[model samples]
Target: MADAPPPDATGAGKRRGGTSGKVADFRYKRPAQPEKKRRDARSGHERSGPERSGRERSGQASPLPSQMRPDAGAQSRAGSARRQAYAALDLGTNNCRLLIARPSGENFTVIDAFSRVVRLGEGLAASGRLSDVAMDRALAALHVCAEKLRRRNVHLARSVATEACRRAANGERFIERVREETGIALDIISAQEEARLAVLGCHILLEDGRDGTRGPAVIFDIGGGSTELVLIEPGGPVPRILDWMSVPWGVVSLTDSVDGPDGTAAGRAARYAAMRAIVDKSFAPFARRIAPYRDTDEGIRLLGTSGTVTTLASLHLELPQYDRRAVDGLVVPSASMRDISTRLSTMSEAERGTLPCIGDDRANLVVAGCAILESILDIWPARDLAVADRGIREGILRSLIAADAEGERSREELQRARDVTRSGASL
Candidate 1:
């Protein structure tokens, strides 16, 4: 199926930093202060706010202009030409990623990007706290992120720490230390917000429903410390999130719960079954809640964003090495995924690691991820699975770009109002 249209800027309108799913008018409100201050209600220094500043990205729809004072119009267009670069940083349980880009047309162009698997939540599952080793590894990755932001001269940025930071007992302390050490503020967002952003960033890749298939689509993000599943009703500027749920079971967490080593084939299978049972139980509530949506005439549309799906998709394609271009947006048979999951469960960590995509870093954890994916597939029963290389970071960029455009629109409106007043006074 062909891809859906990229989100239109007008459709996005003025949104705080998170979910803007409402279908009503999207009006841009100019902030009272030039630099809008973010309030930290829980932690004194933890900053949280709607992304308020940045220049708009390219490829977004612009406001239709009426007769304007030529000078003011020219000035506004010229100002837009001086595009400001924006950055979005997502520090998840297993990886730290950064993207720096400037508005291109309706979308943006990536100027610089960075990604590293630091396993920030490595020991959080068993210890219930971030280990010193894990923290140190994460900080090393963040230090690199900070330098990139500095060199890029980012005009606006939003940094977020996900499941690892959200669940670990030392999460807050770690956030504080990150600020003190790297000069980066990390917002530990709720799982609900996390799901929304994942959908926002990747929904464009959803394939249109085929004949005999229509209705709400299932979009999920399988992370290191947790997994987020979202049920969205498609059609419109943005898909409306009808329901969502987050389970504590993720690759790291699930792997931690199971035994240390894969001894025999039977032992590995048992461990895999145990992992599936854990996820299935966690997903039961959400599965029941969304059962009605599944009964619709349309086929179940499922899209997944995470290392698990990407890696599995890569294996399914028989890629000698990992390739983002070939994997992202690729759709595969659900049976194929299930077969791969079952196959991986039987193999030892060493054997799985030898494969092109599942290296040493992911070897121990991939089994847990496969278990979670199978559980999701079991409940949703989508015939095909869609893969997304983009997620929270991409979503953040879209939000920042939309917010910047809203600000510009508001300023234009104000300018037009002032011009009208002057014209009346002259008359």
Candidate 2:
């Protein structure tokens, strides 16, 4: 929707504005699957139909992410059909993101990507409804997404709405409006489904524990209106999902719950304490259930895939601004995160706004994220917070790509509770 910035001056899109957003060189932070065979999947009400690769749901082939070859015309079309493009669009409570990509061997190359903070769940915690301004902002972003999908002719695409939509009273009305206005139907996914997709998208970012002594890793997605905590057992082409719980708390909703855009140092600490207390109450039951796994004898691995963790990770690195390459898959010490959170808790709103990563857009809300993050650290008590800048979108890409390699996968891919290998790299 806007012009791309000039090439990176330092050769890293670390600058505030640039196309570094276009093609992310994801380390463990980045980079899907097959056809008609569907399951009573945990990822939502999965619709199993004909083979589609980010193509529109017409049951006709678009030929972007994959190049199908007829037994007869294999040689003639071999070099001609290089690759087809696939896309994943995620319209969450706080942000809207779209990834347009083409399959490259085991991974897909990002050709275009878009992200905007729409805050669709802005006041949902109090009002239990999507506000007018928030809906308008979301609509504008979805328009951009629609234009990108039209321009790219994405082969197979899955666009989803998360906690905000699930909670709001007028959510379906807004979904209808989206279809009417942008030609995009938003599916309000269940919490369990969201947890599953999040895992499919980000578990690879977990620190390796394959030596056996490392405890099962905990992966969490701190969304706008909710947080999905998943326990990932050590195994697979991907990490195994042992158990998961979706707590009803996220940055936007939590911030709305405890209002304090003003106050003294003491007052700010009080606000931060309030936010932390809410998260602690929400996390208590889940924490108790996983008490046996809380031992430190074997060492614990905690991983996070969300804006909260990424923002904190960026701040931990003290970057000039947001840098995906530097932040994604980074292992930040738990102590550094706590120290940053403590300093932020004491900062004035204006003071926090002046920071690079926590700008005006995120200034007020980052504190809420900090509360959630600190609470999570308390529960898992891991030494390092494994951060992933990628999540649900990456998960969708993996699922679409893996459809082709379905039955032929190894025991690791099939068993151990569902981990996948993307772009052929053995995770």
Candidate 3:
């Protein structure tokens, strides 16, 4: 959870500084790659095997040119120059996403990525078990993700399941089916790990030097099933994680709790407020614990990752369509965010669906997400917010690569030291 390094202000396409001295750069570009083929001709031919348990048997196919391919020779070079690639997958309450990238200098390039809204925990709030319909939807999305991973030729990858799976009694069974059908394994990560990765993934976005004195900035990730909050200190070999917690409520879970499956505007609004109140109440204990970190003199900045912030960024720009480039890492004024949240609150589901940025797929669920974001804002009251499109997946990828590189370096250094010691003993 190391604090992110300060951003390079002179870089092309960076955010502009505001009166509050917060930067609002939104210059993210989707990694350029060839258009992916919809269906693989050999997909049907792949056999299902039980070589592993829980989604590990979803046999993968050969990767396409657009996916990441590492050079083995490069990996044998010096540790810093190693050309190792890493991959991470996040199967949360709503979306199933995967990212595979090869480290390039200080930053990594996205070679291939996949995302789909599965709403796995769609009815888990009331049912206490994953609904058959929700499971089917999640499996379908996971099938596509498996195909993408196979096509991308991912070598080292970690897939994680969050609150939905953690809470459900049938979660293990669901994971088994996924492995049998899709050949992917889902590791249900702990709340602490979730918070750590959320901070790791988004830390790069909070690189303003003005907040150097803050012992640890508060980082929050609002997902479909839960919200993860982490207090992280800057300037370390790694980020120092002070505190972390996972609230049981997220957009999908809260929506299901408040409004039934068929969430309408009135239903959504009422639920939104209720959900907000619940979340506010839950935060009181954690808030009191971290009260000292809120001092402005310490320079605490709020970093948020998830649909809530990304959707807010999209609405702020009034995009004709959902564009990750425009929305990712965009900073929004607290007032502007509140205004957008207010406008969204007043709109019916149908009206919300009409908005280009929020299609029917998100009309109902987005309100829950908005309510969560608004609540966090009210609690933290930061003048500016740094939005991140990257999250658990990115964090996983970075951690894997960083760990691998460090291990390789450590091995080499140990060998060198051993040789020196042997020479001295011989003399």
Candidate 4:
């Protein structure tokens, strides 16, 4: 996906649940304000992937036109580009998410979006395979994605699988099953590629240090079975990938590594500490690798696009429900996040589940997320944690739109060359 044009605040144009799904005319909005203002707006509300057995890298999509904000009705060829809807599907270990939009000038206006937590990596760490129950759970969600793709009549789309499929022995088989059962072919992407797409998705929200540089930024994504940490260099339409590494640690994998989220608060606390210790070791090599890039002079900014950070952000704000507008571009103090993680670690499953921000589905798994979060804080220890609700889905969409723009530019250049040739012949 490419850098998004500031989104027009998305509202229900014509939303309703149907056979394909609910809410027609879905709009994925980006804030018009600078990322800082958007982050500041969150002072109130709390807010808050894939087995990739596939190691295939995502090729960049066509470049988008300068006039791409479709919700604004920018002019284009007006024949095909106007009607062509682009789509991106991300099937991760824990969830299935899809976004559909027509290229709206330089940016896209999301027409529809779907997200469901399927937890496909459930029990995979212990089993070494995707379980039948987990497969069924994921398939059901992919079916919905297929329907959205079908209903939208998507012309250009990319669907990908991440760490879960990459790790599960049965990952390839499940990909086949998805194609057979739902007609949605999923490519299992490599860890390196996963890191790239995530950077593509949310790098726009990264804040340059006070000196006005984007380098030395550590952006991470925490999924169900794996956590990806990407070190971004300054410049380019997307952040230059200086270095990246994927640890075999995420909510589902981490939670399962410990005894269940039961037992006394003291027991849970001990488990959390143990989880943190393991993560500390997992991240040590990368920490040493990135030692030179470390800088907090202008500012050390850490951005996270994952459930763990988002949930913790929501908890920090004490919001009644998870809210994207508040969470997406917001930056919170790293200390505040660590404090929230500590609090969650000390609570029982029942207590965490009851919170609107976390709820039952995430109750047990989130503590492991906290451990991962804490471990990250231990390493980067940046002043602020930037949260992005968007990830690979946005990355895929942007890539698709950029591909279109690149193609359009090629045609325009060719036409200009032909016109020049004709003029020379007349002379």
Report the C-alpha lDDT of model 1 over 276-385, residue by residue, as the tens digit.
88899888888888898888666678999999999999999999888787887898999999999999999998999999888887898999999999999988998989
TM-score of 3: 0.77
Over 108-131, each residue of candidate 3 has an lDDT whose tens digit, in order, gives: 677666666778998798888998
TM-score of each: 0.81, 0.76, 0.77, 0.78
Ranking by TM-score: 1, 4, 3, 2
Scored by lDDT, model 3 comes in at 0.67
Q: What is the C-alpha lDDT of each candidate?
A: 0.73, 0.69, 0.67, 0.71
342-382: candidate 2 lDDT, tens digit per residue: 98889987898998787877788888888999999998888
Worst 10 residues of 2 by lDDT: 24-33
lDDT of 4 by residue, 1-427 (tens): 2243111111111111011211012232232446664354342112113432111122232222111222424345536765687778888888877777776656667776677788899989888899999998787677656655666666666777887888888898998787766667677776666667788788888744533644478889999888988877666666666667788888988888877645787788788888989898888877887777675455466899998888888888888887766777888888999888888889888888999788887898898988998888877878788898877777777776666656667888898999999999999
Give candidate 2's error at residue 331 in angstroms: 0.4
In model 3, the runs with Cα more than 4 Å from the true position are 1-81, 209-216, 260-269, 414-427
* Deviating ranges (above 4 Å) for candidate 4: 1-79, 208-215, 411-427
Residue 193 displacement in candidate 3 (angstroms):
0.6
Quick one: best lDDT, which candidate? 1
